[model samples]
Target: MELKVLYFGMIAEVTGCNEEIILLEPNSNVDQLENLLKDKYQNLQHLSFKVAIDKEISANDTLLNPNNEIALLPPFSGG
Candidate 1:
């Protein structure tokens, strides 16, 4: 399955980009994707973030589909 991912705040800095299209295995969930991304970019493991499924932040291993729009977000900040 293929999914569109957006990175926000520090996540975008770590990844060096804002958006990406990922090809994932069928039935892959947040945890699996997290691990996969961590493996691909070891620096990502050092930062804390949440996985948003279609704009909703989730901590559970929610199932993802090709059409799903996902995002990696760091804690928001305001001055």
Candidate 2:
């Protein structure tokens, strides 16, 4: 299964992009997927963010379906 991930704000800086597509196995959990990405991009460690599966925030154990639109939303600050 493949899902499109979107990076926002500072998250994009670490990843060097606004979005990318990630492919996962049928039984892959969100945590496993995050680990893969962290391993691939060393800079990701310095950032804080949340993952949303199909516009809904998902936990580390959330299972992703094929073509699900996953988003990596970084923290925002405005005052």
Worst 10 residues of 1 by lDDT: 52-61
What is the Cα-based TM-score of model 2?
0.85
Predictions in order: lDDT: 0.88, 0.83
- Native-referenced Cα lDDT, model 1: 0.88
Given candidate 2, what's the lDDT at residue 22?
Answer: 80
TM-score of each: 0.89, 0.85
State which candidate has the highest TM-score. 1
Best by lDDT: 1
lDDT of 1 by residue, 7-77 (tens): 88989998889998877899889999899888877999999899998888876679998887799989776
With a 3 Å backbone cut-off (N, CA, C), the pairs that clash in candidate 2 are none
